[model samples]
Target: MASSLATLIVSSSFFVSFILVLQLSSFPSCRADVGTAASYSAPYLPSACYGREATEFPSSNLFAAAGDGIWDNGAACGRQYLVRCISAAQPRTCIPDQSIQIKIVDYAPTATTLVLSDKAFGSLANTSAALINIEFQQV
Candidate 1:
C-alpha cells in the first residue's frame, strides 16, 4: 500500500507539471493572437541618444521612442516590438520582408508619433520622407 501511494503521488505531480509547462508555452502564441496591430507615421530621429541622460546607443541598435499613450514612463525601456512598413511616400519604398524588431528606449509624448533610430527608419522606408507609416505590435 505504501509503494502504491508513492507511485500515485509521483504520477499526480508529473501530470501537474506537464500541464503547467504546456500553459506557459502557449503564452506567446496567445499574446500574438490577441495583440492589436497599430499603424503610424513615425518620424526618424537622427541620433539614437534619447531621454534626459542622453544615453548613447550602439550603431546597430534597432530602437524607438514610444508615444505618451503607450509609454509607461521608463518601463518601456528594453521592451521589444515588431515593426512593419505599411506605406511610404514613394512606391515600393519598403523592402520586402523588412519587418524589423525594435526596442523602446525613450518617450515621444502624447502626440501620435514614434521616433525611431535613423537606421531603423532607413531600413523600413525612404529616409528622406518626413514620416513613414508602419504597423507595429509589442512582442
Candidate 2:
C-alpha cells in the first residue's frame, strides 16, 4: 500500500508539471510591437503682439486699448480657445481677425509671442497667426 501511494503521488506530480510546461510553451515567446510616435509642428507665431514688447494683461482691469489677438480659426492648436475667456465681462474682439484675449497666467522668456489658454484665445479674432488685436470693456 505504501509503495502504491508513492507511485500515485509521483505520477500526479509529473502530470501537473507536464501540464504547466505545455501551457507555458504554447504561448509565443516573441513579443508584439506596440510602439507609437506623434509629430507636432512649430508653435504658432503670435504675430500681432510679437514685435511689441512683452506686456502684462490682467483680468481685474478692463483694458482694451492694449493690442490683443485671438487664435486663428481652424488653427491646429489654437482651437483650444474656442469660446472661453479669462473673465466673464470681456467679449470676443474681431479686429485683426486672428486675435484673442490671453490672460498672463504664466510667463515665457524665449517666446516671441504670447501664449493663451484655448478659451482666452477664442475670445479674440480667429486666426492661427502669432498675433491679433484685442478689445475689451469693463462690466
Candidate 3:
C-alpha cells in the first residue's frame, strides 16, 4: 500500500507539472523583456521615422516612440513589440490579462522606456495612471 501511494503521488506531481508547462506555453509570450512605458497624447505627426506621413501610425493606433535603449540609430522605426502592463505605482491600475502589439513610430528621448500612444497605453492600464512597468518582446 505504501509503494502504491508513493507511485500515485509521483504520478500526480508529474501530471501537475505537465499541466503547468502547457498553460505557460499557451501564454502570448515566447520570450519577453521588462521595461516601463508612459502615455503620449495626439499630434503624432511628423514622426522621426515616418516624417509626417499617415503610415507612421497603425490603424489600431497602437504604437510607441522608441527611447534610447532601442533607438538603434534610427533602425527601431517600424519595429513591432508586444507590450503588457505588469505593474505600476498603483498596481490596481493595470488591466487584467491585457497586452498589445505596438509599432515603433518615432524616437523619444524623454521616455524611460518607450512612449505609447494613448490608446495603446489605455489597453494595458487605466488612463488615469501616467506610467506602468511593462513586459515587452519584439515580435
In candidate 3, where is summed lDDT lowest over 10 consecutive residues? 24-33
Candidate 1 local lDDT, 34-120, one digit each (tens): 111223343434322354444444446677777665676567767778887777667776667888888776666645446677777
lDDT of 3 by residue, 8-119 (tens): 9999999999999999888855678898899898899889999989855889999999998889989999999999999999859999899899999999996478899999
Predicted structure 2: lDDT: 0.34
* Overall lDDT per candidate, in order of appearance: 0.65, 0.34, 0.91
Better of 1 and 2 by TM-score: 1
Ranking by TM-score: 3, 1, 2
Best by lDDT: 3
Model 2 vs. true fold: TM? 0.24
Off by over 4 Å in 3: 1-30
lDDT of 2 by residue, 1-139 (tens): 9999999999999999999999889985643221111111223234233323333424332112111222222232212121122222224323333333323323233222334443344444343434432232211
* Candidate 2 vs 3: which has more lDDT: 3
Deviation in angstroms for 92 in model 2?
A: 48
